[model samples]
Target: MKNSSAADSVVLGPRPQYPIESVDNALRILLLLGERSELRLTEVAEYLGVASSTAHRLLAMLHYRGFIRQDRRSKAYVPGTALTGVAFSILQQFDVRQTLRPFLEELRDETGETVHVATLDGTTVRFIDAIESPRAVRVASRLGRSMPANCTSTGKAMLASLSTERLHQLYPEEELPGLTEHSIRSRAALEREIAGIRRRGYATSSEESEEGVSSVSVAFPAEHSALRLSFNTAMPVSRVKRADIKRIAELMRSTVDRAAALLH
Candidate 1:
């Protein structure tokens, strides 16, 4: 049988071209590696919910690209030097972590609470930097921790900047996870809250992401032209009283403007 030419093989509506599975697995692998310095193939497979053979194939590809390497002693896989190089490059140039560390530190000094900078990655927000509070009873949120966007002030602040089209594209009217009683579950309610954030120029979550914890966030403009940088402050509700929201919001606004100017 004669094979069809390449031009004749073009039949589709919108086509899916990117390696979605591999990319998802890659991200999952990176997340797992960030949590632990190393992982076994079985553990990786279990984490990704893929067959051992499939996991091996993905791991082999990553190994080839120097994203993951096999240890000589433990025979376990870990992030490679090349990945570190890529991460450094990203941090030096574009990652939110590097861009906002100084600002976060300043904010921490000003507020005396844990200050964080976070950005949206899919439906979750990734904490890029954190400055710990000096007090004994402090709320510790570390860098690289991914939390639900719908239940976080930083996440909401970024989400508020999105257009309705973009919001729909990012989160469909489907099974939105609810972490606590304060979690936004309905599309209408979420839309309203996001609109409020846009109007108010900040976001607040009252024990939505965690019990007895309150967070305030303001999004800063970044060079990406699409992405938004969020400044997050997590403190006890008792500490940051209702009377203090205005002052905190003012500080966030000033710091974010300065950070944005620095980036530009």
Candidate 2:
């Protein structure tokens, strides 16, 4: 008679069977590395319920394939350069709007104001995602809109990350367009504002992008190739008092840092 345990192992329904055990194990190791910064061979073996020798072989194969690297002194395995390259490629293919929607929504709920994610496209910053405030009186959504790099807080945040030579290349004209009287109107003034933004590690716009909207933004570090991104929260000038700018900016920076960590 067939063993009852063997009978239980066989599925009677439409459940798919994972036939490649080795590939499944390797994929699990990759996921484990992605979630953790480093792991020792013993820890890996214990976690995977495998013998030390088997764990070593798996790790050796992974190291050979450039998915992980062993530290010279600690012997702990960390993500390798190849893994980073693959991660960057995946991020390039991923939709920014979908990735940032939850974060932007949280920010909007936290501040009761509009939140946006934007990226630099040549001399302009384009809004790729936005979460509108629930308040009756709130800033209008700027989704699918583009603004001059020197006019908006999100734009300025991205602009602050660029080299001076790159900035000059983008804005060769002496005078720049202003959305309002508050917007930076000259290259020298815009450069000065960018210097301040770099020093502060965030950017702010006071009725510069629009007549009454004020915003604070922070730029994400370029950990992924060709991805220059920033996020911002905007509120009406009446709602954001002069004294509240610093506090709001700090909060925005904290949120952006969290988002950056998740993406990284």
Cand. 1 Cα-lDDT: 0.77
What tens digits encode model 2's per-residue C-alpha lDDT throughout 117-166? 88766567778778898999999899888899889999889888878865
Off by over 4 Å in 1: 1-89, 92-96, 222-226
Candidate 2 backbone collisions, by pair: none
**TM-score of the candidate numbered 2?**
0.63
Measured against the true structure, the TM-scores of the candidates, in listed sequence, are: 0.64, 0.63
CA lDDT of each candidate?
Answer: 0.77, 0.79
lDDT of 1 at 41: 89
Q: Residue 68 in candidate 2 has what lDDT?
A: 85
Candidate 1 clashes between residue pairs 3 or more apart in a chain or in different chains: none
Which stretches of candidate 2 lie above 4 Å from their native place?
A: 1-93
